[model samples]
Target: MAETNDILEVAKMTISTSIKCNTVRGFIGWHSCDNICMDMHDVLDMCEDAFKRERYQESLEADTYVLVSGVKLASCADSSSGMLTDVIMRAFELIDLSTQTIAKLDAAMRKHALSLIIKEAKKKAFDGWDSWRYELLEKAVCLCDEKLAAKLEKLLDIFLEDIENDYMPEYKRQEDTILRYKLHRHLKGADAVKDELYANLYIREMCIIAVKDATDARNYNEAEKLCLEQIKKEDGRFYRNTPEDWNNILFDVYMQSGITDKQIEQAKKILLLGNEGFWDVLKRLYQSQGIWESQKPILLKELKQCKYSVCYRSVLVKENEKKLLLEAVTENPYNLFYYAQFLVMDYPNEIYELCANYIREQCAQATDRRLYKKVCKDLLQLIKWKGNATAKLLVDEFKATYPRRSALLDELQKVEKKL
Candidate 1:
């Protein structure tokens, strides 16, 4: 049972050592395991055990130490930093839960914890981890007195103020906008923040939350407005392409509202943006409206003109348009191995010729061991499709053309055995 002063001293020393050494040990040995999430929950169970044993002080000190350690560790952590921050929040949650019993004994415990949190929050802000700083400040507000909470809220308001400078990094601006959106929801209440959120809908994170909030509230009108405004704003921004995410949101709004016509329109935009799921959705919508025959060619033509090659090729396969698939293969012979399987049964001779020509071109450009192995791999594909004759000729051609290249000779000898 560590005393409050002892806990404070240990936390201060831990922070100092971590800063000097640039490394941190796991707090309470909770994060030392492979299953960090499960172990963290076990920490909560330990708090419950302390509560059952009437050891409130022990739980408070332990939670306080972990909260401080989490703040420092999260600051220096790399890939797992966010999870480390979660450890801090969860510790705060346990401390908040235990405050009732602990306050009866020592009323200053909460204030002490709040002071330490505020101190760390200020350090984090000075260090430019503004996002982490905002989170700590928010937690501090919850554990403080009314006056202190008000002051903390004011500080948060000032912290989130937008910088009007043009030279700020785009990612920094994005991070600030996200924090501002969060602060707006906290200060203005969720309902009142919607319009402000809509105003900043150019920020992708805010737009996602705004759309989700509207849909979650069953305010389909607001959801539709948000999605449409964002979609319209983003139009022609990405090489004249539609905004895919907002379009999908609008499509969902239409589906929920039973607006088949709007669903069809939004579905086409989403499909053109390379979401293959919308192809079937469009097919269903068109069939529902009895317009598949009239709409099919229009959709296919739009897909063919799409800048996304995968979208075009995928739809060609879905529509079973062998001629267009063959055309795609002709446009890029490297696609021979991919589309050849689909085309070989009907156009066996054409596929064999494509395979032979493609293998020859690959062999002509082969300059290294890796490329030579790749050519051999493609030769195996030819043999798989019963193009043994073509494979034999290509292997013979490789043996003659690159007689002095030892790596190619080795790869060709392996292919000849398969031939």
Candidate 2:
């Protein structure tokens, strides 16, 4: 305490003249205190120095004061220090306008007796905005010309994800969170007022956010209602993206909420939202539906259609579905992907024979690299999942069949440890 007080005393003595520069320099390696420097250059230098020492709370105090002060000062009676704008831009570059830094500033403002300039800076940067993207844009506009700022914003948006080599993960989170905040506000305002196409564009996004917010708050009814509204609006047109059905979110929300219903109207609706059907929701749906003694034909057709379905995988071993699975595998050889999953649960040895036969057939054929690659990937997964004999037979067959394809063998060899 004495050391800090003594340091503050010396810094207070050097506040005005160029030697105040030394006070700013002194803060680079030690503690920062109140009223370090009132001069613009010294304040800027102190902010940078505090930043160098990772003393963010003090740096933000000095930095935000300088940024907002520059804008207000340049337009007011003290336009003599217009170079304050340049100082602000340099500080921005140093911090990369980090959101984590802004968050610290916000947290500090609530706890400490901040300067009036810093208070105004906090309001201007955060009061109305959900995140810091626009504040950064505003800074860019103030530092440079308006047109250049707009162009810079466009380029940054296009390449926000393309940026690389920065080791700080929080910066990326800030960028993503800012985009989400901007999107939420835009959809709530002008987007909700726009024409049909524009309005419809926000439907999925709004529904997603509504469900997420409701789920977070444990408002199960609200989440379910929003999900139902989405399903109703789409009305069987739920477009599946790559590897996911659009209704997957609704299913996931309900499952995660720990709410159960025996009727499973939602579960049945989810089962109807199928895409190759390798997901867990189908299993939950089937379990809820209580596999009737009468649903046999429906089950068979579903098994054949949803060739990669996992909905009935656990029951397939004991149920009548095993014969149908074998038949489906015989009729459509590629059904082995799904069949192997079920068959491995009970008939690992039989599946091993099936895998061997498929490998033999694939090896005998002329090279179809795309098909070969897919088959190889499936074999690698089968081996990875402890399909020992099946993997061994498939690999031995691959070696016998594609011996001359050294490049392919070498690639397979790289994954041999997974064997």
Candidate 3:
């Protein structure tokens, strides 16, 4: 009996060692057969399997082993501490201890396990989004006895205090506001928390949260005011580009409200910012109001004035404004081949002449095989557009102009074969 007992003890130690080895291998895909996900499951399986067998202490032991092993593994590998925190959290949850079971467990063991996970979570750099880790910590609080829960809550407060001293005071202030707001909502209910304006913070995440809260409450006017005020605040800051997010929020509101005038106004603002999806929305809004004809030229003039407007080109094409489209191509010959198909039927001879001139300029400047291939690609496009005669003539012109250029000749030969 003594020898049997000794053998069983050795077997237990061997199994524990094997499990640890597998956990490390699986967590990081260290071995050829192991993957990160599979290894993580292996770690969780030990806790879950022990929990299922009513071995609560062993389940907790599994949690401790995996957390401690994972932390040690993380230090040795290039793996993120955040990932280790996540693994430990999963292991703790898999223990499947209820509030009743948690009350009966060894208090010191539970506190140590919970503290390890939270401490590892804090190892990650605070990015103003540590709310997720706190959320896990909150769950830990519920699982702990009252005394431990208080300790964990105080730890959370300390964590917040540590981040408050981050060098960037503005970010620290805004992040603290958002986190405390979230915590208050979690504790006192969202409705109990009053919405605060965050006009001064460079990071607009808090403002976004406020707008979402107002929108959720069906307060469209409040939501609209928040968006507009945020946009106004943003406009005063010269360092950042105008945030399209405010317009996007108003766009959603206008769409939901079916307010055509507001939709048209929002759509135009988005389109002027080069978001082309709003072009169709704006058109439909104007057409629904039976004022498309009167509004068309006004929109076109606005698009033309917004020098870099993507909607301008799209509008000209869809509106079939051939004259204006041709002028655009003429102004930027780099768009010559792309716009050629649109203008080809109306001005075939002009398209051919433009193709020949563009090819001449490309050949004159192109020094590498890549640029030569690009020029040849355009030449092939001309052929596809029934500019066969022009394609052949340009190939001859490039060969003569770049006679000593072997790479250009090589690419032009490919085009000649296609021609």
Best candidate per lDDT, number?
A: 1
Ranking by TM-score: 1, 3, 2
Q: Candidate 2, after superposition: displacement of residue 150 in Å? A: 16
Task: Report the number of backbone clashes for model 3.
Answer: 1
Give the alpha-carbon lDDT of every model: 0.68, 0.50, 0.65
The TM-score, computed over Cα atoms with residue i paired to residue i, of candidate 3 is 0.65
Per-residue lDDT of model 3, residues 1-419, tens digit only: 11322332333454456546655544543441133424555656655655666655455555544544444554444454355556756754653362226545677656665665466456553243354444444445434555655555566567657664656655545545555555455545666766443432345766677777777787878778877887797683322134447778777876776677788887888888777667788888888889989988888888888855445787788889988887777777756777788899998888898888888888788889998888898898898888999999888877887799999898888888877
Best by TM-score: 1
Give residue 158's error in model 2 in angstroms. Answer: 16
lDDT of residue 208 for candidate 2: 63
RMSD of 3: 8.3
Question: How do the residues 54-122 of candidate 1 rate in per-residue lDDT, one tens digit apiece?
Answer: 766556665655565555545444525256656666876776666555544444665665565555555
lDDT-superior candidate, 1 or 2:
1
Taking the tens digit of each residue's C-alpha lDDT, what string does model 2 give over 98-202?
A: 334443344343233222222343353432221333344333222223333344445446435543643544454454444434433433543353343233333
